[model samples]
Target: MIRLLRLLFWILIGRPLVLIVLGLNVRNLKNLPLQGPAIVVANHNSHLDTFVLMTLFPLSRLHRLRPVAAADYFLKNRVLAWFTLNIVNMIPLDRTKVGKRGEDPLENCGKALAAGEILLVYPEGTRGATDSLAKFKGGVARLKEQFPEMPVVPVYMQGLSRALPKGEIALVPVVVDVFIGEPVAWAGNRQAFTQALQDSVTALAAAAPHPTWK
Candidate 1:
């Protein structure tokens, strides 16, 4: 019930509102995976990444999507905390602190996938200052190694940084484009797969249109 309502509210109201008010324009929706359990790995440009994905995907079906977020930042403030956990269904990930056994974020991601849920992980640990994509972390590779069967979908978002710039509140009206790339398969070597995954994500982002004017 909650999932359905959330999905309807997002698509019917939330997405339209953001689209019209913020001038958001998602170019390639067909590229996004509509079914199955897989990793929706995207480039980290701004905090808008989560909201954009949540808006783009079906909320009811997306109930199983666990967006892996940094515990320190998202869980710190009360507003961002509530928004991330309840609104976006983000899973808190300890990016800075190390847990017992030196567990990595991929372990938690694997658990989510094992439970039949899709994961949204930013290859870049933190948001970038510019629209250019950053170097991906090894967590994505680890997650692939843990779940070789799960497909990793590469995604690129344009003009998000201008729409909602880092350390800013006022949303500037801009056409944000989301490009979903094809699913990448795990070859053989774990290390090689990780590098390939990162490279693929970077290449996808490079292909997508960047913000020319805010």
Candidate 2:
């Protein structure tokens, strides 16, 4: 029942809103992983980032795509927790209390990957200013450390901040550009790998056409 609801929500609302209402200009769509046990890393700018990334894949693969989100924010309320966990298919990570009480912050993430699910992660840890890339956190690198062979796909998005900037509820009609770069291989160390991932995203952002709007 939950799966059906999720499919219906994305098919009827999410896809149309993203693809039609707010146009997407995607390049190198082939770089995205068609299967799971992979990580899709991106620079964070707005809440729409997750929705846009998820829409890139077919609805048939919806169940296999899990966006790693902040547990405090998404699970703050019962209703939202239910919706996000069931409908959005999010894997929540408690950012504030990492490793507390013998809990592994990446436990759920690791489990998801072990189950052959693709993780959509915003390495920035949080949204940043419009049209700017912030320093990435080490969580993504650590996750990759566990599954060293798993491909880490880098993607960059523009115009999403203007469309649905942080702290705003309504979305403006802006054409979002998505650039998918080739997978960034492990650089033999977490620090190096994280830097490489950031570089890949930065390069993609550089390739994107500048937004015409302010």
Candidate 3:
């Protein structure tokens, strides 16, 4: 089955390769809530961020975690689409209509969370500066508002962008650190919640081990 291959690839190859080869380190993993519906929000830097988080999760419950990805980008080709859906267990959002009511991007994600699936969403919408956080979008806020009961845990990582910065095929060995923070409390309005979420991620980034390169 594809699920078995995914598990094998990550457990046998992906996790070890990243953790050992790239020197990826994760912290505050104990902060992740067990036996509950929650979304993990992180800053998007490079592709490795997803793998680092994916490998760090409890393998037994990895099936319950879904990463919110860009439909337009990842699904652009047949092979990539198949890999993302089958192997990566990603839920795609049509970024073209992200905030549009006619095409609510999180429609599928909301349904997934309703079934108690864990989510990994990048609030910045897309990758940004490696050294600083970018402006976050309101999709995360809207989703939280719809599913107010589900907690959104803030996450931050460092050194991935330098390792595999956008467009470079060559991957440099870089020291990476992932910091998971406490769940964010909604601030009533969407705008307030958005700001609070970004702030939470920034706070967590303070703990990243500074990379010598980039």
Candidate 4:
């Protein structure tokens, strides 16, 4: 109910509101897989990355896809907390703690897969300032290991950083490009898996002609 309303609000009101004013050009809608338990991994840059990713699919799939987001940031505010958890159906990830030393949200992802749900995860533990991807964490590798059968799709989002930078609320009009690469095969080895994941995202990012920063 809440999810439906939010989706409608974003589509009819929110996205167009941005598009009318900012002139958002989101392309490559045909690339995303329509069904099954697949891990959609991407390079994280700004808060707008999720919104841009959401625009890649139709409103129907937007209801189906659940973006794996950080627990702290999303849950910080009351309105966003309710929307991300209940509306967006986001899988809450503990970004602060990781590996054996901290509480892992990867296990929850496994459970979601068992339930036959699509997941979106940012292999980069945190958001990056530059276009180049950072070293990917082992969680993605571990998830692949746990579910070797599932495909890991890599997507690259360009111009989102420019749309709404790290510390800014107002979104600037920018032509955002979303490149969806072919599904990456999972190798059994953790190191190898992580490397492959990183490589795919890097390749996708390279596909776009983003302005380089100092």
What is the Cα root-mean-square deviation between model 3 and the actual structure? 2.3
State TM-scores per candidate: 0.84, 0.95, 0.93, 0.87
Alpha-carbon deviation at 159 in model 3, angstroms:
0.9
After superposition, the stretches of candidate 3 with alpha carbons farther than 4 Å from their true spots are 99-101, 211-214
lDDT of 4 by residue, 77-128 (tens): 9998987887667888876665556476676788887777778888886788
Q: What's the lDDT for all of these models? A: 0.73, 0.90, 0.83, 0.75
lDDT of 1 by residue, 74-171 (tens): 89999978767766777898865544565564566677888888788887778876745566667766677777777888877777788888898887
Identify the superior model by lDDT, candidate 2 or candidate 3.
2
The numbered model that scores best in lDDT is 2
Ranking by lDDT: 2, 3, 4, 1
Alpha-carbon error at 58 in model 4, in Å? 1.9
| Model 2 Cα shift for residue 68 (angstroms) | 0.7
Model 2 lDDT tens row, 62-181: 999999999999999999999899988999988867757876889899999999999999988888887567888888888898998899999989989899989999989999999999
Please provide, for model 3 over 44-155, each residue's C-alpha lDDT reduced to its tens digit, 9 standing for 90 to 100.
Answer: 8888778877876788877887999899999999999998888889999888885567787778898988888888888887878776778898888888888898888998
